[model samples]
Target: MKDFSDFFRNPHVWDREIVAVGGDLSSERLLYAYKNGIFPWSDQPILWYCLDPRGIFDLSKLHISKRVKRKINQKRYTITIDRAFEQVMRCCSHRPDEETWITELFIKGYTEFHKLGYAHSIEVWDEDGKLGGGVYGVAIGNFFAGESMFSFTPDFGKIGLFHLFEILKKDQFTLFDTQQLNIVTLGLGAYQISKKEYLRRLESAVGTGKKWTPPRVVF
Candidate 1:
């Protein structure tokens, strides 16, 4: 594998809030990007972004709604980590909200990342043993950079995230990098920090050398 250091633009210079707009999504390249707080979003020409005012989850402050709490306690879904990574990504791309950036090429690239133990997924299965919802992202050190999430049933995505954080907390992970903020994430307790501060945290988080481990089964 060749080094991709030369392919990346300086993330510090986000004249238009875009880190880089064109590059092949190779395993090496994607890994490099994540390590430096850069990620590719679904867009024409495949834009890479490191957004200012980055949205991140502070596990200690996560807000679990009464309904979500009920759903979790009821065992409406079974949570499994890293069991259906590719399936999770596929489902995320097919989400109905908007067109997705998870193209076939992106899938192939991240699949390689999974093989090398750098990417992971959190899967939510209904009682019928079907995939109801899930989330997928790349993991480096203690940082889990969320790529996307989707739900087939209401709040299934939240259920997946709730359990995922449990595992992350138990494993002593530090940062759950959510990239950009939205209503769903905001309601779930995500807060924003300046990109400068984010980069500082990312530097420390990516150096923890914490290996991603599969979560204990949620029955």
Candidate 2:
């Protein structure tokens, strides 16, 4: 990892790696980064990015196991959209081990985006009507820029993800952006690709002239 100091002072550009600048970031800055194919990751203030190849899950290319399918069919939770987006963001921020930059400003900014019909959320509620798992992010046309997720129980992530997948599949979404690579998501079939390729797909999807029409209620 490069020092946060030199990064912002002089942004570096490499063939395989993308540019990374260092500095403070607000929610507005974060959204601007996403739209520009850059994101922030630092305890201090550094912007790091992997240029080559982006990670994505094409709706037509998703690989859901039969067991997971059965479990999803079980229908143990009530899935809702955007009704509790802020709650979903809080839940994702609550997970331990990582220092989250999801500040109060982020919550307010994303909430405003939700009101404008760009951001979305999938919330899973158990039989008792308590929140179990959730996922939230920005959706530009048919492409979903998934930010974070949280689960109160094992496999709740699967439930929340599958629920979102079902809707995207039906709606013919072009891509699902998981942002970065991790064992958990890799196991779920998310893989990495170059930023150029990611940008291409992103442009195509976002430029398709489709409007985001969130479900009246959770699907």
Candidate 3:
């Protein structure tokens, strides 16, 4: 395993070009880089970032609507963590006719992270155990970097998120970094801050060292 810190020591990966040397994506590498507040987003071959403010959700401050709450209470689906990670990522890849940085390389990397116990996923499965929707990302210390999510059914994505929130908040997470904010996320209680401000909060969150333990399985 390559030392991920080395990738950003030069910080060349964040340069955001389609260069050839960006190499492969793996969990060991992301786990190392995530601890340092860096992620690889590539359109083709090279990785780069927009270097703007980041959008985040304070786990302690999650705002769940009565509507979403009722939906969750209905228990229309079964939710679990770290199950069907690749499937969730693949579904998220084909979102709303949008082209994303998520690619074969992205799946390969996060999958590797999943195996390494650094990356985790939240899964929403129907009664038949077929995948409904889910989200995946890297968790280093107390900060969870929410990579992406998707839903084939209405509110599936939001339910998956709310379930994840219950676990993270119960475990005392300091923050949930959503990377970037979108209209959907704004409705889910996400807010934006400058990258510098993000780093400051990141520092505070990481230092707190929160531990998350999922709920006991009903089965």
Candidate 4:
């Protein structure tokens, strides 16, 4: 197995978008990938994407609309962490408007990652105890790389995201990686930077040695 460092140390594959196709989703490989800013995307031939101009959330600039602020202040939903990771992944995989890329193989890989404490989920529950929405991702050092998110009700995903920011903030995490930019993420103040800049920040973040455990407060 060619390690990630080998890819970077080499000249040819260093400039490529798809890092390695046949690498196993073992804990070692997955952790190595995240540490180097690479992540598997659910595509044919199993590509690992590390796009230039990576999308990221600036903690100080995260936007919360008045309506969302009202919803959060109303406290109609409860927030929990890592209590329902598989359930959250399933929810994120089955959306109505799009064909989900979260394949069975992807789930199996990430499930193992979760059991190893390298991945996590933030879930929101309605007042009636129903699953409202959630987000999940992998964490390394002071950095978090969000993989996917889904909402079962209006604004529930946003609620989950809000609490996630709170957790990250309280934990002194340095980076909140969104992987890619979208209308929703851009609206929430996520911005793009060149892959070079991202790597520089990522290097600093991974050296922080921050643990991936969930924060203490859960509501």
Listed in order, each prediction's TM-score against the native is 0.92, 0.79, 0.83, 0.92
lDDT of each: 0.83, 0.70, 0.71, 0.83
In model 3, the number of clashes is 4
Across 67-179, the per-residue lDDT of candidate 1 in tens digits comes to 88999899967888888889998998895767777999889889888988889998999989999999898888888888888999888988888888888788777888999
Give the C-alpha lDDT of model 4. 0.83
RMSDs, each prediction? 1.9, 5.2, 3.6, 2.3
lDDT measured at residue 21 in model 4 versus the true structure, 0 to 100 = 72
The alpha-carbon deviation from the true structure for residue 200 of candidate 1, after best TM-score superposition, in angstroms, is 0.6
- Superposed by TM-score, candidate 2 places the C-alpha of residue 131 at a distance from the truth, in angstroms, of 0.7
Give one digit per residue, the lDDT tens place, for model 3 in 1-219: 457543454322344322224656665556555555566777355563434567889776667788878988899798878767788888889856777888887888778877766677888887888888888887767788898988887777888888888777767777788877788888788998776676677777777333344553312
Off by over 4 Å in 3: 1-6, 9-23, 208-219
Q: On a 0 to 1 TM-score scale, where does candidate 4 land against the true structure? A: 0.92
Candidate 4's residue-wise lDDT over 156-202, tens digit each? Answer: 99999988988888887888899889999989999998888888899
Pick out the ten consecutive residues of candidate 4 with the lowest summed lDDT: 4-13
Clashes of 4: 0
Name the candidate, 1 or 2, with the larger TM-score value: 1
lDDT of 1 at 175: 82
